[model samples]
Target: MHVLLTGASGVVGRFVLKRLLDDGCRVTILGRRPVEGFETGFCAYDLADLDPQLPPADALVHCALVHAPGKFRGGEGDDPEQFTRLNVDGTRRLFEAACKAGCRAIVFLSSRAVYGDHRRGETFSEADVPTPDTLYGDVKLAGEQALEGLCGPGLNGIVLRATGVYGVSPGLADHKWSGLFKEFAAGVPIEPRKATEVHGEDLAAAVALVLKKTGVLGAPFQVYNVSDLLLDRQELLALYATEAGLSFDGPAASAATPGEMMTDRLRALGWVPGGRDRLKTFVHSLARRGGAGT
Candidate 1:
């Protein structure tokens, strides 16, 4: 299968590309910049001006967009416009182009952000209506809509409403572990909410599982919330503090706050995360970089 993946240079895209390649699929990548060491074909294209002639692919993984830890707070207005241009408009164009080019499956990397940052106990299901609070969430929701509209019921369009995904990848280090490692290594007080997390490898594996199933078709749009373990700020601080040989400040919140995701759907498909050992690797790697806590 010739799979066309956007954002092949991104944190998640790298894993997705690697997983597809491992499964013996010929993958083509489209992105703003070139990725290193990938022998597969790559095309640089602006998301705003997607051309159908770029490549012939069996499936298209739409992963390119502007997203960051705190980007939503600062780029609310400007970000939404740019996000809509890329995520919404770009998705529409690519879905159309792929369908025309005989592509039948499109897995869009959506977000739990589409449901807002409400601290509720409700486990958000795929059946729940989206109520985005931030512009980032709104644009992602719009992108989902665009893809759904363009593909209709003939293509398999799955939306993975992923939580905070963490893993080790070169040229990308600004993740949950990076911050904590910096703070702990520097002997600074580390405070991190013991929130839900998904390893990049596991996330890639989930995509691989979805791709393996040929029976699922026609914009099936599976919205699964992926996350493995949960921790609070204080507990994580204590653990990392002990690891870094430092003392931790008390936690900010006491409640066992429900994290931003649910993995029941992914679990039903026989998916399970590799757990915090992956994060420990990242934390140690960051520590080797000289900063304990950043």
Candidate 2:
């Protein structure tokens, strides 16, 4: 399959790109700058531009967005209109361009933020309706709605509401837990916070599954939550401390929340995440990389 991928240089997008390439799919990347080794078939354009002359492809995996730095939740200090134009409007334009380019299937990388802040013990499934509380969530939900509206007889759309994605990327040190690692390494006290997370490789696997499942494309639209682990920052810090041979006496364990972003829908499709084992490996790797030193 020939795939057109946006944000191929991003953390998650890079994983998806590698997975697609390993699966023997021809890929064309659309991005503002050429990826270091993938310049041969690159389209240089910003998502806000709404370029019409997109290259033809059999499918499209859209992972591009304008997110605030280290503050995706209501951190977009840009003009509201511009944010909408770049994300919501930009998504619609891209989908239309994909349709015009004869693409039959599209997979959008949405976010778990659409579920809003879950009350303690609250869990979410694909069956739950979105109640976005932040501008970022609002924009993502809008993009999903756009996909729903655009799906027709010949088009198939899938939205993966992904949770916090964590993994090591070359030359990229500021992953989701980078700050926590640095703080721990510096012996700074850390607070406890709970959240759901998924590995980038697992997310890419979900995308690959959706792309290979032709039957899913026959449906008008589909939405699935992609998450693996429900973790507390304290527990993770303890694990890191053990691996790094450091002392970390942080806050006590917080009450567990029952309401987590569930991945049953994707699991039903035979998708299994890497779970905490991957998390352990990742932490150990980070420790060895001097995340524990200074």
Candidate 3:
């Protein structure tokens, strides 16, 4: 299968790119600049100006988004208008172009923020209607709808509303929790926090499962929540502190209840995640790497 992947330079996209290649798919990366060592083919097309003239592929994973550096929820910065234009509008255009180019399956990487202001501790699922609070959530939800609008006879779209993604790749140096680990190692007082997280590998697996069953996937548009563990920061950081020979208990467990995003829909597709065990393995690996910050 020929696959076109956007945002291949990003952590999540890297996970997807490596998995697609390992699965024996000929994957081309599309972006402003081609990602080194990862691109089987490179299509440098502006998201704001998508062209159907780009090479065709059996599947396209739309993971690219226009956002402020080092952020996502409030990634618009000082330009919310441009943010919508690029992320939401650009995504819709990309969906159309892929559909016109006869791409059988397109998986859109949406966010868990789409379920804004839900009751505390609610187990959010695909069935719940999105109530985005911030512009970022609104934009991601809009992108999902855009893909949904384009699903039909020749197109099967999948929207994976993912939660906090955590992983590391070779030569990447740092990851999402690297800074937190640094703070903990340096004896900085750690705070208690908890959130749902999924390994990027697992999220990519979900994408692959949806793309694999394209023609026979029954539904033209499907939304799946992709997340694994409901982890507490104290417990997570404690692992690093323990391994690094740093004596610290961190803060008390957070009283704030963390919500869970149900992945049962994706699980029904035979998607299995690396749960708590995976989380421990990742932390341990980082700690063994001469301290996580390094």
Candidate 4:
């Protein structure tokens, strides 16, 4: 299969690109800069001003976005107009162009932000109506809706409403937990927080599954909540601290209720995450890289 992947240089997109290449698929990357050591064809352009012309492919994985540095939730800054222009409008243009380019399937990297900040004890499912609380979430939801409107006869679309994605990536050092790592290493007191998370590799696996399944194409639009763990930040940080040989007293229990994101729909298609074991490995790698002082 030939795949056109945007954001090929991003933290998550790079992993997806690796997965696609490992699966023996031809890939064409669309991004602002050329990926180092990548021999695949590349198109350098900003998503805000995307060119309609694109190489033909069997499927497209859209993951490009302009977000605030170091933050995913409500990180659009004060410029709502530019945010809409880049994320919402640019995504619409990209989806339509992919369809016109004869692509049969598209996978959008949406976010759990579309569900807003869920109340404690609330588990989100695919059936929950989107109640975005920020412009970032609102735009992501808008992009999904736009893609659904564009799908037709032979075209199919899948929206993966992913949770916080974390893992090591070459040339990408600032992950969702970068700050926590620094704080834990310095023995700074950390506040307690809780949320769901999924590894980048697992997210890529979910996307690959959707792309390979022909039955999904029969539906005009499908949405799935993709997440692996409901984690407490204090405990997670303590795991890192232990691996780093640092002393951690841990934070008080968080008053905020925790929530789970159900992935039965994606799991039905044979998607299994790396789970906490992978998380442990990730933390170990971080500790090894940063050393005991980190």
Candidate 5:
């Protein structure tokens, strides 16, 4: 299959790009900059200007997001209007362009943030209504709605409401927990933090699954939850510290409300994510890579 992938230079997008390539699919990246050492193809366009016709593609995996550097939850920075214009409107335009350009499948990478923090300590499923509290969640929800409205009849749309993604990416100096690990290495008193996280490789695998089973996706618009481990900073640091032979202090556990999502829908369709084993391997890799910033 010929796949057109966006945000190919991003931390998460890099994983999807690599996974698509590994699956023997022809990929053309649509981004602002050329991906180093990548020989497939590259197309340039501003996120605010996704008005051009795309190259021929069988699938469009949209991972591109316009946000402030080093953030996604508060990515709007100080420009919420611009954020809405870029993310919400930008997403709608991109999907329409892809469908018009003859792409059969459009996979949107939505966020678990769309569910908000109000459901403290709650588990979410596709059946649960999304109650977005922040602008970020609202934008993502709006983007999913746009896909639902525009995709049908010869176009397959799938939304993967992903949780926090972790893992090393190509051409990046830092992983998601670089700060946390650095703090631990420096003996900075850590605060207890917890959330749902998935390895980048496993998240990529979820995307690949839906791409292959586009026909069996049932509805014209399908939504699936993608997540793996319920990680707590206290436990994660303990694991890392053990592997690094360092001492981690503070961050006493509390009655923190845990957030979880149901991936049974994706699992039933043969999508299996790397579980606790992968989490351990990831920590081990971090320890091996000097533990400070790897």
Candidate 6:
């Protein structure tokens, strides 16, 4: 199979690339800068301006996005137009390009953010109407709409609404979770929101499953909530501490009304998730990578 992957250098995209390669798929990566170590075909072009016909493939995975740890800083104050320009407009361009290139499948990397912050005890399902609470969430929902319009009956379009993703990666020192994990491991007092997390490898596998499945996917804009583990902040901290030979210093704070989408739909399709063991493995991998000393 031939596949075109955008954002191949990103955290999730990197794993997707490796899994595709392992499955013997030819991949062409589109990004702003040329990747250094990857030997696959590289196209150094912005998603908004790339010529889709340059390297055609059987499928296109839209994974590019303007993301930072916190709020989007590059945009003007509360002007959602800017967010639409990047996330929605950029996605529209890719969808058009991929369609024109005759790609049979287009997979968009969306987020649970589209569901917004639900009230305590409220859970979102694929059947619920999207209610975006932030500019980021609104923009992602717009992107999903654009992708769906461009993918008519001729193509299979999928949207993966994923939650927080955690795992160890190369250059472990600069990872987002490094400091938090270190604090937990060393028994340093800290407070972290009990939240949901999905391992990168499992996410990659889910995308691959969608790609390899030969069908219309049951819906035009097929949406799936992708999450693996659900743990309170205290439980995660305690697990890390135990792995590092430390015990919980005090009573952990109560878990906030958990914020995560259930993954029942995806699992019904035969996608088994990596649970608590995945988190433990991530910490162990980090420890082996000099994280214990940091």
Winning candidate number (lDDT) = 5
Q: Please give the range of 10 consecutive residues that has the lowest summed lDDT in model 4.
A: 285-294
lDDT at 233, model 3: 86
- Each model's lDDT comes to 0.71, 0.84, 0.83, 0.83, 0.87, 0.74
lDDT of 3 by residue, 94-124 (tens): 8887776668899999988999845568889
Ordered by TM-score, highest first, the candidates read 5, 3, 4, 2, 6, 1
Strongest candidate by TM-score:
5
- Model 5 residue pairs with clashes: none
Candidate 4 on 206-239: residue-level lDDT in tens? 8888888845545778998899998888878779
Q: 82 in model 2: Cα distance from truth in Å?
A: 1.1
**Superposition TM-score, candidate 5 onto the true structure:** 0.97
Residues 197-242, candidate 1, lDDT per residue (tens digit)?
7788888888887777634532366567767666566665666666
> Cα deviation in Å at residue 115, candidate 3?
0.6
Candidate 2's residue-wise lDDT over 1-294, tens digit each?
Answer: 999999888888888988898898989888887777543377766777756568888999999988666566755676777777789988999999999999999999999888886445788878888998778899999999999999878888999999888886533556777777777677777776777889999999999999998455447699989999988888888998898888887656766653588788899888988899999998888778867422
Residue 11 in model 5: shift from native, Å?
Answer: 0.9
CA error at residue 68 for candidate 1, angstroms:
7.1
Query: Which of candidates 3 and 5 is the stronger one according to lDDT?
Result: 5
Clash pairs, model 6 backbone: 194-233
Candidates' RMSD to native:
3.0, 2.0, 1.4, 1.9, 1.2, 2.7
lDDT of 6 by residue, 1-294 (tens): 888899787777887787888788888888876555666787665755644444677888877776553343233355556556766777787788888777888888888888877544467788888987777788779888988787667788889998877774432335547677666666667765666678877888888989987364676568889987766777766666666666677336765666668788888778987787777877776556655534
In candidate 3 the C-alpha lDDT for residue 213 amounts to 75
Tell me how many clashing residue pairs each candidate has.
18, 5, 0, 1, 0, 1
Cα lDDT for residue 80, candidate 1: 55
Segments of candidate 5 deviating more than 4 angstroms: none
